[model samples]
Target chain A: MNSVIHEKYTVAQDDFANAGKASSHIKEHLKEIGVDPQVLRRIAVACYESEINLIIHAYGGDINMDVFDDGSIQLVFKDKGPGIDDIEKAMTPGFSTASEKARSMGFGAGMGLPNIKRVSDEFDIQSSPEGTTITLLFRESK
Target chain B: MKLHELFNELNWDNLTPDVSLDKDVEGVYCGDLLSWVMGNGLPNQVWITVQGHMNIIAVAGLREFSCIVIADNASIEDTVLQKATEEGIPVFASHLPVFESAKLLIEKGV
Candidate 1:
């Protein structure tokens, strides 16, 4: 199905203050569209964790939410920063390289990526020295 | 119980009542970690934490929390208070520690 709307949000490194704004926006949009509350919460958590990762790990990134006519929502995050060296290692729970500052903020629990994967119905990630991109998909319950 | 009833019963310092006090209290959660709170918190729960950053309001908003109680008399900036008002999530303060408040809320059947 084709996307009905596409929303773009840019996240900057070390912008802890505004880390979840994009996720909040996406959640609000989904709510306004009358998405199921449980599904909305799942999306909100995944989007928030993804957004926070972009802020804490990536130098900078853009989060895009694509809403399709068939009630599926896809979130894509692309960051221009030092990409992850190992996907499998990063996916392991309790594995993190976040700084002390990020940890003190109640983040860097090493659960961000795994949590996102847990909530998302479909997840994809790709990275290189130059940048990284992560895509998360959620399908509406029948 | 509604947030206002709980606040009055507990004798908590009302930092701001601009947000709705009629919101129901589902349960209580205590933590300073923003991400953990966001991931685990449920709607209408009274979030007890020492952190007073504006993101607290944002997290409460996302999770649809009834209100926020800053334990141990943790000070919150005016900007955070303002944001709480904007988000319609009441912000309160307690001289007691988070554990004490949690116990009290549980006793009251939160």
Candidate 2:
């Protein structure tokens, strides 16, 4: 089984109105494809968290979700926004660089990245002054 | 308990009339943070919150929560209500606070 399903979504900065549209669509697609319930929940949380990060923190970015036949799911979050200066500090819970607008929306509690990491089986982050890219991977049960 | 019973018991103003009430709520979760709820809210739970933004509907729908009760009489935005109707997720507004709503729901065996 070498089949692969890839979906792409474009995210705009401060686009709170349509922030979770992509994740919602992906959730529906995954449900239609018969993803495990627990796996679906993990993906849903990680995907939405990642999507909001792009909307609130990034200048702009795109989310790529790939589901392979080998029962592995990977979410690639690539952003062209200002790269994180301190990955360690950013990863800390309750540490936030979010703006007032984001805070007002009840997000930016600095739990987005941590929650995403907690939900995914594998997490990788590559950041620079130019941009940031995060990869989250999960394996579906046999 | 059935949504109608719980709604009547708690005096919740049904925000989405087009969506009927027949869900069996098994638990309750109170939180203002969307991500926190997204990661922890269990299915068939009635989510109590003060955040009435449009994205709340997305979170409730994604988690398949039995219903969403916006506490303290917080006004739900029109877009949020419309999406709730479209997604068939029952939503209600409670004049009481989150704690009161949770207490009432618990008494009602939700």
List DockQ, one per candidate, in order. Answer: 0.60, 0.73
Residue lDDT tens for model 1, B48-101:
999887678778888888889999988899988987887678988988899998
Q: What are the per-residue Cα lDDT tens digits for candidate 2 across A1-142? A: 4539998999999899887889999999999989998889888889999999999989979999888788888889999969999999998877899899788888887888888889899999999978999998888752
lDDT of 1 at A103: 79
At residue A107, candidate 2 shows an lDDT of 86
lDDT of each: 0.87, 0.88
Q: Tell me the tens digit of each residue's lDDT in model 1 across A1-117.
A: 999999999999989778678888899989999999989988988898888889899998999999999889999999997999999999988788989988776778788888889
List TM-scores of chain B, every candidate. 0.95, 0.94
- Distance (Å) between predicted and true CA of B94, model 2? 0.4
Q: Whole-model lDDT for model 1 versus the true structure?
A: 0.87
lDDT per residue (tens digit) for residues B24-58 in model 2: 87899999878778878898999999998988887
Which numbered prediction scores highest in lDDT against the true structure? 2
